[model samples]
Target: MRSFPVRLPSGTRYWTVLDEDLAVVAEADAFLRHVRFGRDQAELTTRTYAGHIALFLRWCARTGRDWRTAAEELGLFVVWLRYGTKEATGADRPSTEAGLVLAGPGAEAVRKPARIENVLTGVRQFLLHGITEKAVPSQVLALLYEVADDRDLPPEARGEGMSYRMKARHRVQVPRAPRDRATDAEIVALFLACRCARDRFIVLLLARGGLRRGAAAGLRRQDVHFMPDSTALGCHVAGSHLHVVRRENPNGAWAKRQPPGSGQPVPVDVLVVRAYDQYVLERMERPHARDSDFVLVNPQELTDLHLRFEERGGSSTPLGRPTAS
Candidate 1:
């Protein structure tokens, strides 16, 4: 659409503004911000959504397809995600059609099932958002819910009339292998490997108490109470307990489930209490110990010790996984 000079009856000339295509990226960004601030989702969550949605938009732009009206091609979108090839070296681009499945040079890399599923879910959410914002027409929005898996429902409950046209949303997701838990012997060996009080205490804290690494790291001095009755304001638990507090810690640890300003009490065994006492009385009082409220801090990299302690606290961040045998 071009703007032409319009002659006015009173000898004045004027040009009308021409409309252009909507900026998809800008629109997507606005939607992302709405997701971040409006939905109160975590930074990492919003970032993942942005990455997935951006790929879909990029694929649409590269393939010259109207993403708004491409509901019928959703299956094709999944296929393209798995085997699409772009002609770039530094970064790979998404393509519409599949090329030769070569293992060597110029071959399109196939994505894992999980990754493809994530991208498709992101695209689905984006289209739904478009419908809510009126960027996409209401008619096309019906395609989003066109797939329904109601086989488990009673025969009378199923919408027999409208359900025929509705296909299953996507393929079944790939099953992941079960994670193996650390054995009791392994836990004992890990505890034995620690040379210092802090390291030993951290290991005991996780293996015995089943505290996540972040929860352990986020612990404060007030959180640990060896005595059954403590003077701390919020320490009302019966046994010797350490509270997992969600705080914006000076050090970089965070509680996973406990929101900021909340706390979850976890009981500790007598052995764990002894370890805590040893850490506080003997090792933590060392002159070189960093002045921080965090329960676990490395006086030195314990991984460099004689036993070569390669456990979580010694070398890097706490392993966080529960030690379940």
Candidate 2:
């Protein structure tokens, strides 16, 4: 067991955590190995993806690059990634105990530099996810990529006597913008005209609260609780605020319910609680064929909201009342 170095943003020696049985890298690798694959095999197993992510984080720690500074200093960290992997191995894999010490000088210098490159790529992707989620600042994101150049995704496998051209074909698409945000005006307007309690609540939660749409969509009647007895509540609304936190598979579509990020409770003001209560009461009055575990019904009561928007524009309004167009 040996520890590797990491630099925290505060300028403290974050310390080397990869050592013996207590190695952080080893634990992370083990955690990733048993990850479950959802219905979509094309998507990486959560654990597998996480394994790549840890390789990056440990390297960043070793190099003293904050999440914000990673883009520019990534190459330095990338250079050392292979060494970290060689130092850490699981029972299921071939031993890499002497991986670094045994390699020739040229191999040490050029030595599967591509593997390290892939790890850096993985970290960049993870940071990008964090940025969109607001875990990291966008300025750091711009600086990190403002200087990167590469051979795209390097290959996962290589051949003994393959053609040079064939070798270069394997590459990964770098992180691209996949998330789109509603314009502030659009978001603000949605809140003003939203007649449905569910729609109105989700809009505010996302914009003002910075919550993801998925998190809002997943809220359940039980998951929501109100704070009572203070100015926090009125008599009709009682004495409680909406408790916002992680929930079961909000829609019950996925095997597990809690979203990728974390969760919490939101105590809406008096007006919001009243709207939610109204939405629930009205939802109970309707008789739909499908079952809903949701606190908010598909304004129109459609079973699938994703497809409802694409295939059935007629039901776009979610009860003929769109979230402000």
Candidate 3:
């Protein structure tokens, strides 16, 4: 099975699962559509859920077990999820090796505990959705969750006391790791290593402006206000700042939803402003970039600039993923 992207007449996109015969899995499609339109989730969220559901469906098909039956024996699925080879999903490839050849100690598990947890979470949600739609037997809920009271809860959580909740039966214990952040020296190094003003501006925008990748990429030229006072331009906010607005970008970049009473523009430092100035000069050299309204645009192609940077490891460790301040 594979996950396929579907674009609707309204230009909204979602993901669905397709079997080996290239037929859409009816149940998976219904659930994913509900997630995308009914729940109003991001397109990427549906993609992720579709991928997870596809994996679970593939595992069930390969093991000759019905999805309902597989849910009852999810322990075996968890073990397989931890150690299963990529080739296990393919019909032509063998699932096991004949002999063990020692590889170096640096080898890591096929799937990390956190990733496994995410997969299980998606699968559980899919199963619960199926139950709500009356497609799956209600008895399967017993295997997936356990009802428990709030007797051991803290005072704040207890509320009025005697309240009960259903807890997931399957969960992976993931170890907490320190949040990775880029140091000042590393940020400087990245900025210095950039070959062009655009690249430098990208580095500064992410590191200094505290903009999320999607927000930075989704920024429009009009959203940037470099003037100290911008009453002439019609924007009320003063100082050099950039607005982070949520929009449906063709490049698949999406800004996070802003909370109520928090739609003010984000302030940018002098360095970011200076970098933007230089980037503007460089961007003007490219007709395509100059014509595009987006603040960040690829001079050579229309692909997502932030995603390209991520693919080139520009957002990797030591320069951990940028987040809004």
Against the reference, the lDDT scores of all candidates come to: 0.62, 0.48, 0.80
Candidate 1 lDDT trough over 10 residues, lowest sum: 316-325
Per-residue error for 234 in candidate 3, Å, reads 4.9
| C-alpha-based local distance difference test score of model 3 | 0.80
Query: lDDT: which candidate is best?
Result: 3
Error of 1 at 92 (Å): 5.9
Q: On residues 173-291, what C-alpha lDDT tens digit does candidate 2 reach at each position?
A: 34455788789899778788977666776676556555555556556555565556544332233445443454334242222333343334445566566666766676665444124
TM-score each candidate. Answer: 0.63, 0.35, 0.79
Q: Write the per-residue lDDT of candidate 1 for residues 1-325, one digit (tens) a residue.
A: 1122334474433232121242335556656666645765434455567667656665555556787877657776776676654432102432323332224566564687888878777677778788889887787766666655667667887876545445436553766879798998998899888887778888888888999887787787778777877656565677788788765444446566654553777888899999888887764444333334556655543223312434333543332321111
Instruction: Rank the candidate models, highest TM-score first.
Output: 3, 1, 2
Screening candidate 1 with a backbone cut-off below 3 angstroms (N, C-alpha, C), the clashing residue pairs are: 213-320
Better of 2 and 3 by TM-score: 3
